[model samples]
Target: MTSIKTKKILSKAGYYIFVSLLAFAMCYPLIWMLCSSFKETNTIFATATSLIPDPFVLKNYPNGWKGFGGISFATFFKNSGFVTVLSTIGIVASSTVTAYGFARIRFPGSKIWFSCMLLSMMIPFQVLMVPQYMMFNLFGWTGTYLPLIVPSFFINGFGIFLTVQFIKGIPRDLDEAAKIDGCSTYTIFLRIIVPLIVPAMVTNGIFAFIGKWDDFMSALLYLNKPQQYTLALALKLFCDPSSTSDWGAMFAMAILSLIPVFLIFAFFQKYLVEGISASGLKG
Candidate 1:
């Protein structure tokens, strides 16, 4: 019995070690990018195997800030911020209201509508991309942020689904109590439901923020004007096939672009975890 217990402990330890190594491997690229960003162009090639830069440089940052053709990093940052903030707010507010209706309120065709919502999630964004682009073109919204920001007002299927799951976890007794106090449905949603599901809101908000921040293809396809480009699009400008790429500056910008996302995640990480956990528990 003693021998068996010892073997089990060793097996668990081995499993943990394997998992840790796997996690490190998965994260290695991000670590490499961060280190490479601080290195000079020649130094990067020299210290290819080393994680730490032997000679660090801060010039890459300013170089990256002034991207190709004098396009400023400030412009990209501002554009991205505008789109991300508007989209995040829209997604959170719309998704919350839609999720509340689906989770708690009974209405005609609610079940069918809910099923349709799930079905929408199964449809690939690629399938819709061309049609969406055509629609935007028809409205002459191309080369602007409208194509990116406008759709966010409509509740995203995944956000709605996730929020619904979290909302379901909240006790209906709260809704009933609110009703007894002569609270309207909208008031109940505002005063009670919104507060209770703040964790899920944070989770969804973080996801939306990240999605907008990292969006590359949409920005590439829709934004024709360099001045209106997001960070993702701006990063691609650093890669010049005509000459050797400014890899150090490119990586530097990439690292700097992640700062806002990191700050957001750090701020709301606890709520995000709680929201996800609570949703699963309810489901």
Candidate 2:
């Protein structure tokens, strides 16, 4: 019994040590970026291997915030916030309704439509980008936020799938009970389903928020004016292969850019984990 107990202790210690090293490996890039942000741009590459900056300059934050073309990083942040918030709302609202229909309602061709949605998930966004760009250009939406914000109103396949799985876990007896009380389908969804599916909704909302916040491609393709640039686009302004690049400023801003996402994840981490686990197990 003593030998067995010692073996278990050794196993647990080995597991924790392995996990700690793995975590550090994964986090090293971010840590390096943070340290590099305070170093001089020229020395950044020279001492790239080092985690600690020899002489940490405080100018990077101020200089980066100054931004390019007389536009501050604040504008970029505002634009990102606008797009992310609206896109998240659109995702949650549209996906929730669609998931409800797919999960709870029995209609002709419902299964077929759900299958099509699943199939849609298999198709990469790159395949549709050209056609979408052409269509948006024809609509004169290439330079506008419409192209970025409009498509989010439609069914988000992953979000719908996640919500549907979560909704499936909910007892159907609740729906029947609501119906017996003379509640309409819409009424039941609003009053009964929505409240119970909070975890799934929060999960989808967090995913949507992160996706929109980190979306560089869509923003780059749609927005042309520097004033209308998102934070991701603004980051590009710091890089110029043909000329001097403010590596320090870029890294500083990049670190600052991560704060919102980090804070969000830290706060909603419990819900995110619970939602994903519950959805996976239930649906």
Worst 10 residues of 2 by lDDT: 51-60
Instruction: Tell me the whole-model lDDT of each prediction, alpha carbons only.
Output: 0.92, 0.94
Flag clash pairs in model 2: none
Which ten-residue region of model 1 has the weakest summed lDDT?
A: 63-72
lDDT of 1 by residue, 1-283 (tens): 9999999999999999999999999999999999999899878877878989878788998888887767789889999999999999999999999999999999999999999999998999899999999999999999989989999999599899999999988888998998999999999999999988999999999999999899999999899988889999999888889989899999999999999999999989899899889988895
Best lDDT goes to which candidate? 2
Write one digit per residue (lDDT tens) for candidate 2, span 32-99.
99999999989999999997898979899999999988999999999999988999999999999999
Assess candidate 1 and give its lDDT: 0.92
